[model samples]
Target: MGNGHGLVTLLLGAILMGASSFVQGNSSKHVVCYQGTWSVYRPGLGKFGVEDIDPFLCTHLIYAFLGIEETGQLRVIDAYLDLEDNSGRGNIKSFNALKLKNPVLKTLVAVGGWNEGSKKFSVVARDPLKRAKFVDDVVRFLQRHGFDGLDLDWEYPNQRHSLENEDRSNYITFLKELKEGLEPFSFMLSAAVGSAQFSAELSYDIPAIVPYLDLINVMAYDLHGPWDEVVGINAPLYAAAGDASDSTGRMQQLNVDAIVKYWLLAGAPPEKLVVGVPFYGRTFTLTTPDGNQPGSPHIGKGIAGKYSREPGVLGYNELCELMQQEEWTQKWESAQQVPYAFRQRQWVGYEDTRSLSLKAQYVMDHHLGGIMIWSLESDDFRGTCGQQRYPLLHEINRVLFGANTPTGLTQESSDDKPSEGFRCPAGAPEGYVRDPDDCTKFYYCSGGNTHSFNCPVGLNFDLSTKSCDYSSSVKC
Candidate 1:
């Protein structure tokens, strides 16, 4: 329903931190950030490159999902991007290059994602020779690419994708082999495990694998989404009253509290359990106009966003942009501790600064290792929604490390900075200025510099608060 992210983060595991602090691997707490490299393909505001990352925010940066061959070899999903060309633009090198700016950051590459599926991985895991080659390939691939570790993002091992984990016991056995191969290089080994009990029981012998894993990233979000017949929050902190206890405890198991408890009781140590915090929201097209609340029926996924261009999900940047509109009404659900907004039939349940900060506090209270953001790319890196660029991430950072700052948080990248490439015109000294070259763009001049922006499609650039409008509404 979403871009690969709909199930991807859940597939890899989940969201936040704004303002970079030196949250290193050995630090008292963990802040794991997964970068969906696919974001590079997104145009305009949605484009997020490694250079866009705030190096100081996370201790661990996992470059999401390198592909795996059926015969048990690592494959670069985008060799054109990951590998260095004659032109020397390699995403892998640039991704790992962030460590130069932040020496404390531990960069890792993940293999397997929702799209990669389980069949290839499951088959490889069951074959000893194939598994050994896979382990060796992972080690060599990481070392060659200069990654500090490998994140085993198998989605769920035993779930019948109809491919992965058919043998059931192959996952633990595969991990044993992977551990041996990785240990020699001192590479950190982590896994993105399922959250709810149903998947947990089906996928893991957690105790057996915990011994080999340095971090067990709980894919704690995505408990419910468009797939469900009824509406639900993307990542509810606590079970809502409406989430009445069912005979199977499906509702109870869907929240963060229950998911964490299940993992702890199942034998994961508090330090090893890194909780997932989702950065994006799941959207739905309500079956009825008034059916905006959670548990309501839906016709299908909500309309795709202006950016991200995915039907069933909206990136935080897209969500915030919608919130700026007059028709969209955002409301908080006290029970779930997350927010949902709707304009007509479109509804989405998503996280905010308050929810993320509370989740950080929850991690501390529960004695969990740290909070892992589903991604760094989805946050409002453009600072389009006011506040700092990554308001949600910043709230968690401020709460977790007391990283206090006013005005600009740090020397942010001008790659997507507001009015980055434009300049103030002589006639218009400040405020919104028309682009000299193109009518489809404008600049917001402030603080003696031009803060430029592109006018939304089919709209003429104008000097108004609305930013852009149809040709008939205003004079260009």
Candidate 2:
């Protein structure tokens, strides 16, 4: 669990890189977002579609939940919506067509999700021929669908309905084979990894797996939910001191910083690891209304929203609406950099502009590749809350990309303009701008414009101080 060695090495690398002028050169940081195919079915949620996505906001957009067939071949979970030519409304076609708007956007198909389970992946990974066929079928499927690559979201590799022990090493072999097969076609291969320490340690051979991956998206959210007997934050950036409901000591590690550090210590490259952020919140109903802090007693799932319609869950859009109610009060957890809202006996743990800004800053300070949002449909894309559409995502862009304008908007309205001669650029390739005052501090350039962000506390912008030092060493 110790990250001392990795932390030192990472900082050393950053220092060496800082000595070179190339460190200031433009190098794009990925903004990868997952779009749930099922969201289109939720009519109450405005039936979000691929067209609602702003291709400019994401460098890579993953269309999620492709399943594994019983025959071990990759299957489109929704055949009608994915391949129906008559309607010309296929999700695949519509999603890929976004390239016409922004050629730089790369579309990927994410196979498997929490609901799909791991049985198929276990069967395919254990059998060499089956694995080959699965890889071959997926490559062809992606090609036919005009997708840029494949993202293997097995949910997990060696736990919960999977071959727990052997699946760990077998996963590495399977990825190697898949990568080799995809190399001929130049398809990108990535995986969605579990964040819990036990599962993460047992499920991945980090060193071996990193070599075959173009990106490794850590599912840092869902650390706590209704599944837990006690109420907790959905995706805390750090563990608060009072949480002790879980005896396994795992509760302390259920946060973004711990999860990312675990991967780094396990040999995953920082640049290849993209931290995942949830666009939704985990809701819970309080058993005792007076005591509503995290780890307090909770009876069951919170009431479902009119749009999300699922108990114990609310999308960012729904949460925004809930915020408008006078009864709901919001509180920020500074240690975790997350927020929770309570109204009467209902509570929901979610992220907002303030917390997300801190998360984005973490990504930059830690020298991680970038941020990945769980699903796009959960965001308020219609500007309904008196804010610009996709406000949460826009905050991410503002911090990570220096984008002054909202994702889909070409320019801010004259009334909202920052200054007379400063029109924000529509979009620009991701890169870094040097800070004149400090080499350890820099501005991340995304949609175009520079937003100042600093390195972890005590760390400077100089090449030597680009990566984070040990927490004990830094004031942060």
Candidate 3:
């Protein structure tokens, strides 16, 4: 979803995100990891599986994209890989089993990503019986599979893929009904939303639906890439002055700052907002080596990563391997608080550990809920960069949580865990307020007095539900 454009490679499937690594945080912030299930097929180093994942790196892990048919019934995108029935691999159970490693983790199944399109969802939402049946079927599927919730990666409602605009209202009805149905099971609901102002405006009535979601994960990357005329920051923190002069004329608002601001202005509460970050780079082949700046013209397709082998994209690990060599020169774009590198003809823009740290602070500064990663396997899980594995994610967690976050990504020890001591706020309302430093702790208020408490070991505080619940079942 981050690569909203029709990049030949990123357009392949349900725009997905994932998490893996050994580090766990009591972070009150959300670490949503989306995994592209097909990465398991990546020839060698790129091949990843649920067992390769670390349960603690993310608070919630999403299995992207189960499919939905025209009739509103759900289907597995890859039964041979996802189910165990009929001698299948049973990835559904393997993905959910990450919770056994970190019981507080939330596992969710996503339906209808970019490739899945909007027609089937629109058709279902428009029909009362179909919508109800779909919701019922989804809940049963989740229960049978032991998932904590469902993520709607519907791409959009009322988008061009759909024939009618009634999708906007119908989506609200669907959410309302889905909420009522899931409430009995305490299953949290989330949606992967587009970040562009034009698409978001067309796709959702943000205010009307915010009340129904636990987290609103904005696919905030892909602001610029090979789809555009120049070498632009893939997820620029701020639009540069020269960007406005671009041929497409989208430069002014095609940035992370503007996208998040638009969502806030559109009535999405700060706490429910989880900004998306890419662990990969938008790569392109430069038309001229000398013109290597952000606006440099490009040939529109860069060399594929040795691992991902996707023409227009490179995983962070692939980019890092290139940067490790003396020939590749990396530069920092201070104007955008981002990083990009050029190795002769190939120019790529992507987020690094430093940029992600800045983004972590950005999330807290804006009082936004947390950060969402595009996929689990793209990060340097193999430690090929000669650093600890999953450095980008670990950096974000350290900054978002506290200075003393666990350093071990593979093993947990009682020694590194710190205790929270957040003071109760004065003149607070009579309810529960989760600790900003600890996902497991909450401060309860009654008659202007407060007492701090912790969620059961396997759960986290759900601000939306006003109680402690499973990570997948709670809204941050």
lDDT of each: 0.75, 0.74, 0.77
Clashing pairs in 2: 15-463, 15-464, 18-463, 401-446, 439-461, 439-462, 440-460, 440-461, 440-462, 441-461
- Model 3 residue 359 lDDT? 88
Q: Which scores higher on lDDT, 1 or 3?
A: 3
**C-alpha TM-scores of all predictions:** 0.79, 0.79, 0.80
Q: Which candidate leads in lDDT?
A: 3
Q: Tell me the deviation in Å of residue 64 in model 3.
A: 1.1
Give candidate 2 regions above 4 Å deviation.
1-27, 86-88, 244-247, 404-476
Error of 3 at 366 (Å): 0.9
TM-score of 2: 0.79
Worst 10 residues of 3 by lDDT: 13-22
lDDT at 55, model 3: 68
lDDT of 1 by residue, 1-476 (tens): 11221122112111111112222122357788999998888988889998788876777899987989989988888888788866646898888766444334677899998888888888898889999889889877876777878999987687857765354588888888898888876778998888998888888888888998999999888887889998888999999897775776688889999899999999999999999988899999999989888888997788676767889888888888877864787889899888888888889999988888889889978878988888888899889888788887778766666652111123332112444356665565324456766766554443354443444335565455333455666576
Per-residue lDDT for 209 in model 3? Answer: 95
